[model samples]
Target: MKPLHARYPFMAGAREAVQEASVDLAEVVATDEDVVERALERVEWALTDGTVGDTRRQTRVELLSYPVARVIVSTVDEHICTRKYAQAEAASAHERFVEELETETELRSTRQQHLSLDALLAEFDLGTAVRETGDGFRVTVGTYLELAADQWGDEWRLVNRSLVDGEVPVDREELYVLLKQAIRHRVVDGLPLSVPDVIAENLDEEVERVRETLSNMDLTTEIDTVVPDLFPPCMKHLLDQVQKGEHLAHHSRFAIAAFLTNIGMTTDEIVQLFEVNPGFGEEMTRYQVDHIRGDTSPTQYSAPACATMQSYGDCVNKDDICEDEINESHPMSYYEHRVEEADDDELTDWREGAGEDGDDDSDESPD
Candidate 1:
């Protein structure tokens, strides 16, 4: 990647400004300058924040994300006290910001990046923005409010009326809080990071060289009971497919059932997942799922290796996570490595606000 100054010129431009103290009204008669420039305090805070590092951080990339996060929410955005910008200008600015994000050299490598919001909302299943304004785009708030009211009652509806009507002004500090969250999210997601085209060709060549080696990574006897929180990318893909009622290849089905079985799912639950398919046969599906769970075999069947999964065209999201973790030949090895990391105090919560035990994991103590 090019230097940060080159990639994000806007961030490079947030230089220190000239500082001068303001005159205090009450103290003006008593003292020449009783006022302090709070800007100086902000500058100091930024400096302190920019330099502080968690010595326990696993990678330098994670440390780098801190400053990038600050830049995304602070250096790059212009704060308006009110929704006073022109609609056309806001749209233009939004477009430019997206282009910058799309081109970010470091984004793809950082981790939680997803399709840009516009791209995601472009699909009708997600629904189109009901009303567009200079301030922001919003989905059909009526539908949301109806659902909220149904779940929480009429008081929830009353509270959301201001939000739907734009009567309640957005608290500026709260906006900053949300902005920081969004910037932090993009950083953690590894948005927009991709290999340079020149290097991408080299990666393809290199991956091809090691592709054959993957076939031998299959596992037979050594299987670990990995928790769902630590499932490898390919396994997660299969789980998602089944949940969506998509057709799974034979190997994919076996791998998924074996995995769910290992993680404590019963034969009936596995069979139920397949019942959504057209022309579903409950008896046949039950038998097949039970067979994979090893009811028919002397020993339990284990999930396939990454190489075998690759042969099934299932290893599409490989970020070389295995190589980064332990260079494990099998997917189970990756799962075990994640489980170890997930046990650590500083690294355990991979899913936002979710605990290893499948409960809400709040940083705060309950009152």
Candidate 2:
């Protein structure tokens, strides 16, 4: 059997009922504290004595199964707000909550199957006298019954006749394979595999076939080119570098993709990078591209770079900031120094100074 969520159409009904009950609870409970208290007491009395109590006794079903009753009492306990006021108003509000809950419960119960093991046993003409053992329930069956039995046996004796030595021997390998198949099946079917017996039985080829059918589909178009023309220029450059024997790290591609994309790198450049970079996987590159295109800020590389520098500060140089100079100091600090040097160079003319080239220095010296 599939999970209730998957097999039973009532799941949708249950969900709808719960939602309706919640709305009703909100509408019934008085907004003021005093009015709410009085209204809750009245609602509680109606639930305990009038509808909920009666239904439980009549149907012999648990209160949890009734969404309306469950909602009202639970809401009272949870202190839901109601809009009613005045003594007359409180009574009216209380009645509305009670009525709503009752309606929801009736709707849900009417839709529910409410089948028990005994009912199923009767349907299959199975005997129920077998007592439960530590492992599971056991029963006796005749040879005649075995011959006529369907896939599911009415009694243990008929089922055991199909098993070796009158008992089923567990196959560990088959069990694992079946379990994996069952999980996949449940995922595709949107079912919860809560029962072990159901999982064990459904974890075979049928489930696998269902899962495969749901999953099998191609969702991509192929563009032919060693370096695709559609790729962004920066990405193409990086790809060229990779193809030329530059050992690009996985994080480097991610970082560069973020940087280029932030600066308006095109899709062609992105595709080219993936094509040329041996370190990059097609799927991984696609994921990065999607991330860049999405609402996330184009700053993925900074954090990882900072983390790397922090953990391995001694591996970098503080003067040049170049990868070669990155040794035993902060690489960012080295890069900053390089920027400072470039700024100084741009501001000054170094060839105009020295000795006789400058007459002002001699004049300033004390004679």
Candidate 3:
């Protein structure tokens, strides 16, 4: 098996490599212990660490494990699990590609086969769409829209970028970011594949383990009650920025929106919260908030974990409650903890007075 395929098993070339090798996927899963073990590691590490775990030394094993891992994930058949696996795989590939790009030209060649930036772009048919200028690159508006995720932050939004003609300017770092999203889209495109009965039966144990891990990681919080005062520091910070008509990064917006959605705020209420923002557009705001609430999207996301919040520089003003790693590792968990500790008298139901002042203002007759 090619080392390049092992490094980027999501690439179409890698699938072609496997097909050319005439590898029998079902037979590999049933008979190859190393491949099966590596496959299990791929899924498990993805769940636990947001990585597929390194197995670079065993090229064939690593390459074969990817398909086996897909089998196991498909057999498990959980959307969240599937999403996490795809994300982790995409992330690992992004890191490797970035490292290769940063390597000196002479040194990169000496290294085992690796796809150059131009080659990688060509592989995805982005050659014409992403053109390098003297200072940076300008991506075609069409390609930019297809790859840029609003979830990355405000910077990725078309309105927030410099548009020249029909192209949007992006620096090297931004191009890499788009490529990562491209990899993720490719990886997740045909996911939850239809597994043959033999392969599914062979992977039953791995499937069960993945399910168990998913259960533990399921961040779904059922908070039918609304108490804004109990919001975690990160959520509070994001919400404050929104109410003050300050610009919020996309990740921050997502963190707060997901946290609120999980904590019983309807899409309308959430949209109202952001109406004061300078960049607010009623339709887009409603659509984004609805997307986060899963009213208009396929995936229902929970508030990011504390680590993720910190990663995007969204985590701020950690109080004593947040300092406790045991209980407050996630914004939703922190909110849940605070709600549990709060007495009824100390909690204000934000829902009770929500939009009432606006309603009153509307009802007032013009004198």
Candidate 4:
């Protein structure tokens, strides 16, 4: 969104030059209109009276034409000079002249600002090029005949040959009318026209075809119909579940049907609810019904397979032991159990003898 002046510095100066030139031209034209008129009259009188020699007469005519021409020429020259200065002011600016020219050309072409066929003919003295072939006529500009001959071979030959040989001759007025009709057909119906008769007939046919198509189209037909009551209750419920952020392993359609069946949802009511709920669609509800009932019907499961645990034991471990606790009376019991049974008996005998000796000494001293 940068301004054109900011992006292209040269354009800024060019624009300023254009404005100055325009103002200068306006002032000159306003003040000197009578002078220009007088000059023109003088040149005209010279031409009529033969008062001057041929060279002087030509010079007078050139002088008379100079004012108007100079306005245009000087403005353009100033614009160019300003643009060069602007470019020098911002040498690092991106190269945009070519791109701008191309964009401008495209816009002008699309807006039909380019010279019309008739205008080109008048301005360039270029005639319409055409050719003859067995199929139809091919018409193009004189300069484009070679390039257009391929795709429009038959039509080109027919039109060109007819025009050249004066077989289907046409005057300027007739040609204009025919050209307008052809252009209209090409623009509106995408139909190519080679001859005037063909153009008229094809245009009519294309119009009729379009009318027929429009008449046949039915806008009221239901392209996407939904049946709510037919959807299983579980499927509808699954829609709610999914909406609530619960994940499902299998297709929700089967799950929804199963859930509905489990909750005693009738086929008719399930379908009705499905129809009423904006969240659930008929296809999803159908899928749920198929999934829950082990229904292998074509309508049951449309999604790919998913993994799920069928029972709690399927995912539980029965052999796991608690290693963080030890018996209070036998902290080393676990380690002792790892010892040989014979070694354990010898350790117990030694502890018992030590307990008997301590008990005897305590009994004698207390008495």
Candidate 5:
């Protein structure tokens, strides 16, 4: 396998490279310990860290592990796992490509290994759909609509963009953002592969390990109810912003969505709460929410850290609990601390007054 294949295993060229090698996947799974271990790490790290972990020095091992990892995820046959694995691969590729573009140099130690921006665009059949402009690049409106998700933030909304002659213009950074979506689309395409019986039998132990880890990470049953009273100050601020029908940037939306999901709010409940937002699309919102909660995919997301919230300017209305050094490190921990200290009467469910009439003074969603 080539170095580029190792760096970007999702690219079409990499797929061709693998095919040409004619590697025996079954034998590799059974005998090649390094390939198997790397494959397992790919799934585990994707599940836990949203990364594919470090790039191995061995190009061959790294390239081979991509397919093996796919087999393992497919064997698990869990939608959430498949989604998480695919997204993690794409996210990792994006980071590397961004670095390469910024520095205008190869990220790999091997010379002439990194792909150029033009190469990347062509590999994905985007050459015709995207074109360069004086300020930056413009993507055909149809392609833009296909790749951009409104839930990504208000910025990705078509109305917020500069449209000219059936094309939408984007700066270098914005184009990369779109590329990330494309990469994700490519990685997720044809996932949960129909693994041969031989390969499946050989990977039983590795599959079991991943399944066990997935079981521990399941969030659906972990949170039973949403308690706004116990929410961290930052989360409270975010929830309040959403309730007011204000626009949240992508990170802010993710922060709030993840916080709510982890706190036990159902997808429908979150959707109802967000209904007040202008241009609300129920289908899109629910899919994004379900994706975050690992309902439709294998990647469950937790709320960002205290530092991340502050970085995005979403951290607001800090309270005494937030000032506590030990208790305020993470939003989840803050909520847990409040829950531990609150009396039964002090802990009220947010759903209590969320009735059809919406008569309650509290911030409740109407039926």
Candidate 6:
């Protein structure tokens, strides 16, 4: 078990700063209660950039005792580690906050797969048994359902605005939507909160350390800033979603990483790009990026076809660029044509299949 200072050396200078903030927490929280968000902004840069493959430091995130560490880590862990928030990655001497995503809020539930009136009743769990009727389910007052029912009529919180103390018929679609919301709320609000102000200087110092670490990486590849604009719309959309912290479907993620590797981005740069995503996990991102780059094996993989992107729901709202007649084929075909048009100066470092083969070393694709 590494101490906090050993795990996060940038924290050394910030300890005094955080101690000061803890003492003034009441005053700070009174004015700017959103210091929690401020803490998250800097902590994210620290965690993601500082410890990419360093398992020991990453594993020690559980021991951090800084104020607002819980909330800040909560936001980052969900995306960076893709797990429910842990106040500490391990059990804490303080109150242990266990955010089990499955029992809390599962994206897919058994109820969701096989939904039926009778099945719904068995699981409705309004803090009591669901009273069934010939017309619909009965909702009595003094039940948890009452809180959900209060928002009656259109724009109601509960699915059925027709909820009543006696009996109101339920729509299957409405019931499903209601259950879905219930699932989301648990995940969204399950993060633990701290009562006092978090140290700003500590966060700033940690963020600086992360920046230094990234800047020092020996990235030899050069990617054109304009290159992303030429990506097929499905790829562009997937990139947009991840950059905005949205999680990608498996195919979209694989497709984008493969496409980037083909277009002259190095493994490190590609990994950094994935770090911006909400579902970023160090091990998973590293494994996938390496696999796509052919660092793991000799298999050369190509980006998925346009048809595959459509199947993943990524190729939508065909932007003007995506609709171009020239790029109607596979994503790699689009890159192959566009690179040929780039200035020879930019292509000075280029080689055939370096963009699509995922590395300077080339291997023939099975396709």
Task: Count residue pairs with overlapping backbones in model 3.
Answer: 2
**Residue 173, model 6, lDDT:** 38
Q: If ranked by lDDT, best first, what sequence of candidates would result?
A: 5, 3, 6, 1, 2, 4
- lDDT string for model 5 (311-362, tens) is 8888898899899998667887788667656654565456643432233332
User: How does model 1 fare in lDDT?
Assistant: 0.40
Candidate 3: Cα lDDT at 70 = 87
lDDT of each: 0.40, 0.33, 0.78, 0.32, 0.80, 0.45
> lDDT tens string, model 6, 1-367?
2343323222322345455435454344334434433434334434344221222233223222334444444323222221112212221211111111223334325323322334333433542434556664544423324323312233332332344653334543343434433332332344433322354333444335434543453221212222564565666777887778887778878888777776656676666566666668768877887887778979757677777777876667665544677765566656555554554335333221123323232222111
**Positional deviation of residue 303's Cα in model 2 after best superposition, in angstroms:** 6.4
Query: Candidate 4's residue-wise lDDT over 1-367, tens digit each?
Result: 1233222212333236445545343343445444334333322222233121121123223232223222222222222122222222222222222233336555756642333334423322334453334653444433333222222122323333333433343343333333333322222221111223322232243234333433353311101111222222323345555545454444344444444433334344345445545455667665555444346454322211111211311111211111324311221222222221222123222111222222334342111
In candidate 6, position 8 carries an lDDT of 29
Give the Å error, residue 192, model 1. 39
Give the winner by TM-score: 3 or 5.
3
TM-score of each: 0.32, 0.20, 0.64, 0.15, 0.63, 0.31
lDDT of 1 by residue, 1-367 (tens): 1233222212212111101123222232123111112212222222233322222122223222223322222221221100011111122223434554456567645644333434323322324423335764443444333222212222223232345452222232322222223332332233223323442332332233222322232322212232454678888888777767687777777787776666445666456445556544678667766776678876677767777888888775776666674645677668655653442233322222222112233212121
Better of 2 and 6 by lDDT: 6
* TM-score for candidate 6: 0.31
Candidate 5: deviation at residue 137, Å? 0.8
In model 4, state the lDDT of residue 237. 41
Clash pairs detected, candidate 3: 153-250, 154-250
Pairs of colliding residues, candidate 6: 62-89, 79-278, 262-355, 262-356
